[model samples]
Every structure is written in C-alpha cells, then in structure tokens.
Target: MRKITHKKAAAVAMAAALSAALLAGCGSTAATTDSVAESTSTAASESTAAESTEETADESTADEAAAKNCADLIDAIYVQERTADTDARCEAAKAAWDALTDTQKEMVEGENADPEYFGRDTGDASKDDPRNEDEIGENELLVVSFGTSFNDSRVADIKGIEDALQAAYPDWSVRRAFTAQIIINHVQARDGEKIDNMQQALDRAVANGVKNLIVQPTHLMHGAEYDEMCEAVDEYKDKFESVSIAEPLLGEVGSDASVINADKEAVAAAITAEAVKTAGYDDAAAAAADGTAFVFMGHGTSHTAKVSYSQMQTTMQTLGYDNVFIGTVEGEPEDTACEAVIEKVKEAGYTKVVLRPLMVVAGDHANNDMAGSDDDSWLSQFKAAGCFDSVDTQIAGLGEIADIQQLYVDHTKAAMEALNG
Candidate 1:
C-alpha cells in the first residue's frame, strides 16, 4: 500500500476542496451576478491559500527525503571491508551530510548513523596522527589494534603505543591500522581523520616497496582479533621479503586455567600496581586489608581462547593479589561476569570496590559498560548489589601505563630480533 505522508495528505485535501468548490459553482443557478462575483472572489482566495499550503508541504517532504538519503549513504559505507567504490561513497556521504541543514542533520538516522554519527564531540582529532602517509622506506612497522572511536583514548593509548614503537625503532617507518572498519568509517565521517584498515595498511606497505614488515597488535590476548590479524598478515606475507608478527600484550593462551606465563604475570602486576597507586593505596595487600577489592573488566569472548581471562585471574591469585578480581563483559566462562565478581568480592568481605578496564584503550566498554550510570553497567551492578561501602571507577586504559607500553615495545623487539635471526 502506498503510504500517505503528511504532505500527500495535505495535497489530497486541497484537491478535494477544489472539486467541491467547482461543484458548488456549477450548481449555483439561483444566485445573482453580483453574488456570483462575490462567490468567485472568495473561491479564488481559498484556492490561493490551498496552493500556498501545498507548496510548504512539498518543501518539507523534499527536505525529509534528502535527509533520509544522506543517512542511507552513511549506512552504505559503514562496513568492514573497503571496496573499489569506498572512496567515492565516502565522498558522497560526507557531501550529503554537509549539505543538510542543522535541523535536517538531526533527522538523519540509519542502521549505524545518527545525530551522533557526525555531531558528537569526542576530542580534537587533529591532536592525533592517522599515520597513513606514503613515501615510506623498505622497513615498515604496522601497529594494528581493535581501534576505538574515542578520540582522546585513541591518542593516549593507541597512538601512545605507535609513538613508542617509532622511537624505539628509528630505522622502521611506523604506521597505524585499525581492525575495525566501522571505527575507521566513523573517524573518517566524524573527524575527517582517515585511518587505514589492515588491508589498506598492508597494501600501503606493499605499494611503497617495503622489504620487511612487522605487525604489532595491541590486543590483550590471542583471541578472535589476534587470530584475524594473523590471517590478514598471511595474505600479505608474500609481498614482503620478511614479515614478522609480534606477540599480543598477553603472550599466549594456555590450555587450561592452571597455565600462566610471564606476559600474564607482568600485566597482572602492572595493572594492579597502577590501580593501587591511582586509588591512593600503597599496594594490593594494603587495599585488601582495608576491605577493598579491585575488579578488572575485559571484553569477553566465546572463543576457546577465552581461557586467557581465566588464566589472568589465576595469575593474579598466584601473585598473591588476593584483593584483585577478573570479570568479563560477556560472561563467557560464567565465572567472570559482573554479578559473579560481585559475589566473590562480597564473599571476601570487601566493603569497598574499584573497577578498571583490562583492555588496551578505555573505549566504549570502559566508558559505558564498565563505568556508565546505566543499570546494566558494571558500576551500577556493583552498587546495586549492596555488597560494598563504595564502588569507585578508574577510567584509564592499560595502554596509558608506562609499563604496559614497555610490554609492547618488548614484544616488538622480540619480533625484530627473530626476524634478524
């Protein structure tokens, strides 16, 4: 059925009124000439008013159609892979968005586009580098990450790692790539900052005639993202003479809960120490003695490597971080859920809780899922559990810590050494 929009309804009403006036005029045979003239004048005035109303409605309908078209354009480009038409599509979407009036822009909506699609103020995007420039030498260090749309976190965490790698390996050209193309499209659409995806970054290196390529992923574990990064590098391995991929922040995923490695131990110590110092405590034991527990939230997964989260918990326990706990947003292992962690903290008789993200960048999970005021967020869940005297949050990512950055540097160094060897 054809939907009758408001403008269509108004047009239909105007046409019906015109038909009625014509019928009344044709049936008025008893009226005098003077009365006929007066009636004709009144009819002419009504017709003019109807035409004016129709024009306004038509304009409004056109504006709405334009805004919807722009939204659809944005939705089309919000994809994981960049195609041959991606550049043209991006240009078209930006043009349409710019042409919209302030009011029309607000009306824009799509599967992934909204007013916040281009209007949200994350931070000054200019402060951070996209690092997509060309004219690179043979050796290229491609830093890959899951990526974040939060501008400040991107600068402080992701860019922080890239800068450190550039300084450590002055001979290699450091470039950036984000695994999430949705974030890539978002940053481009919102801030005009064009970040390369894995394919683009790799292709860039191949095109620039880079002989050696090193991929350093800022991921915390050998989970889905890390596996995907490895697959991407395999596709481009033949392009470079020597291609090496570094270990993720957490080195390896052990078979079961009983396995823990040096990488996990370092992360456990570093994050706990940072959290303790930030919370104004001397150490984890001191915090525990004071009836405070620190919970680290990770982005859980359904993959078999979800054991990494469990191993992290075990490593904390083995390190004697009795006050530290591990939790996941997805609750993959059933024991790492927010509710489960709360129960553990309560059982341990800790009346105070501090929550922080174990992820590289304190992006959406850290800002919204971990510390947001929503009822389902970790912060709200802990407070509503009524098991703590206070529930505080530390809105910092692991990448911001000097020790965490050094871990990536160390991993990159290992990869470089292996490539040389």
Candidate 2:
C-alpha cells in the first residue's frame, strides 16, 4: 500500500511541471511575433515619407520649367518682324504663346508681347493724337507712304502728318503703313526700329474691327507708290464698313493745272523763303537780285505722273520767278536733268546756286544723290560743271513745313466729304 501511494504522488508532480513549461514557451513566442510586426510597420512608414518628398520636388521643378518657357516665348515675339526669316520666328513665338494656359500667360511681364500688346499704341505719340487713347475708335485713318529707314526723319515727317490728321479728326484713330518693304527691313536691321508694313497695318486694323477707314497718303504726288497704296486699299475695301482715300500732299493732277497750282506755288514760296533765310536775304526777290539761283531737286520717276515736274516749272515761271530752276535725279521731263539745269542756270547769268530737295522727305535722294560726297553724285557733278562761283545745299523736306501739313489735312477733309457724298 505505501509503494502505490508514492508512485501516484510522483506522477502528479511530473504533470504540474509539464504544464508550467508549456505556458512559458507560449508567452515567449507571442512576444517575438509582436516585435516583428512593430518593426515591419515602422519600415513601411519611412518608405511612404520618402516617396512623398520626391513627388513634391518633382512638382516644383515642373513649375520652374513652365515659367522659363513663357519668358522665352515673349522675347522671341518681340524681335523685329522685318526679314522673312525673323517673321517665321514671330509666327512660332505666337504659336507657343497661344498654347500656354491663362496661368502661364500671366507669368509674362514687361516687353508687352501679350494679347493686349496688339493694336495698343505703346510708344511716345503726341498727346493730342487720338491713337494715344486706350479705347480705339470705330473710324480709323491709315496714313500710307513710301517709308524711310531714318528714325528721326520717320518720326518727324511721317508721324508729323499722322499727328496733324489725328488732331483735325479727333474721332478718328490715326495709324501708319509703309509701302516699301526694303525700307522697313533697312530700318529694323540698322537701328532696331520696328515699323508695320502695308499688310501688318491692315491686319491690325482688321483685327481691331475698324468700321470706317480713310487712307491719307503722305506721298508728294500720284506716282507708283500712290498707285500701290490704292491697290492695297481696294483689296481690303470690303473689310471695312466704308473705306475712302485722300489725295497726296500735292493734291490731284487730272489735266487741271489749277488743282496742283496751289501746291506748286506754296512749295515754291516756302522753299524760296527758307532759301532766302539761309542766304541772309530779306525775301525771294532779294535772293534773286543777289544772283543766287535756287535749284530745287526732285525725285524724278519714269511713271506717267512725271509731268508734275514740268507743270511745277511752268507754275514757277507763271509766278514770275525765273531764277528758281527745277531739276530731277532720274532726269525726268528731259529739261530738268542736272546738266540741262546747270546750262539753264548759266544762261540766266547766275553766279551762285542754292541746292535743296523738292521731295516730302530729304531721304536717300536728297542726302546721298543730291548732297553726297561721291564723285558720281549731283553735288559733285554740279561742282564739276564749273558754272557757279559757289554752291550751297539745304537739307530739309517739304513735310517739315506747316503749310504742307495743312494741305494734307485739307485733302483728308475733302476725301471724307467725297466719301459721304
């Protein structure tokens, strides 16, 4: 009986020891599994933070690139549209500018290569000029001319006429157009001055939705340049509600001497007044009496309108100014050639001569052809003739005169009346 009881007690002790061991092993396994899960959670959080930072950096870089592109496009369009190649650049710049969103467009500042830049008179125009206004008028006055590349002359001569017209017609917006592409290119290339050609000016007017347009030519006569302006006006006539053209500075010459007589007389008198002032004479008669022969130089052409030069000579004679002689560079009217003029001045027994340009602008013909230093020029040829004791030159254009400007203004009024009639 004692041996069996001891055996039972030993079995019970072994079972209790086994239960304690199993519980301890389960606790250690649970702690290890919890530590592994915590470590994995921490690693996943760190990877997510790193990716977020990289995404923010990429967005910032993209914004900077967009800003740079907008600036580059603005500069490219600001380049002068004179040459054919540069015009292509302008077109491309325009395309790129158009592609940008409103947010990107707002990024562009100074230099004004924006949508508002078009048809906005941003330069220094006169205060009285209607073009200085922000709101453009329905009626537009386009002043067309064979443009000069000279910056100062272009402003003083061409802009002068436009300003006058703007002042006269306060309701109209005065714009500029150059018929000569070569001059436009020359000015832009030489001086970096940008001017609108015939097509560009017309395009701007059309874009602005101009209703009434009147083209007043600054040309001296109805020559080839005038004819070309007329053709351009005819092409775009239907674009406007009403379009009319004004006569040139010298008015019309349709077989009526009276119509152009006033211009010739005014030019002759104005030039004589200026000449006498330069010669230190009291008046035109005084200059003629002092044996100072005034030779007015003109830009003669092969156009049928060349007869205007002959008519001017006849008008000068009718005004009883025999000392004043008219000559041309291209030798139009045959009698107005430099050589013929020289002989005529000698025959009139003039000892001294005054040379001046008869054109509206004292440009290439006046500066280089008439008064240049080259041996082939008119000044050199006149000096070579050995006809006068001394020859003096006057560098001034007809457009500089106040009366000439008024004449253009009058012609514009007449054209408006004619269009209304």
Best model per TM-score: 1
Q: Which candidate should be chosen as best, given lDDT against the real structure? A: 1
lDDT of 1 by residue, 106-129 (tens): 899888878777776777889999
Candidate 2 residue 376 Cα shift, in angstroms, is 1.9
Which runs of model 1 end up more than 4 angstroms from their true locations? 1-67, 100-106
For candidate 2, lDDT tens digit of each residue in 306-347?
Answer: 888887887778877788888999998788899999999999
- Pairs that clash in candidate 1: none
Error of 2 at 235 (Å): 0.5
lDDT, candidate 1, equals 0.89
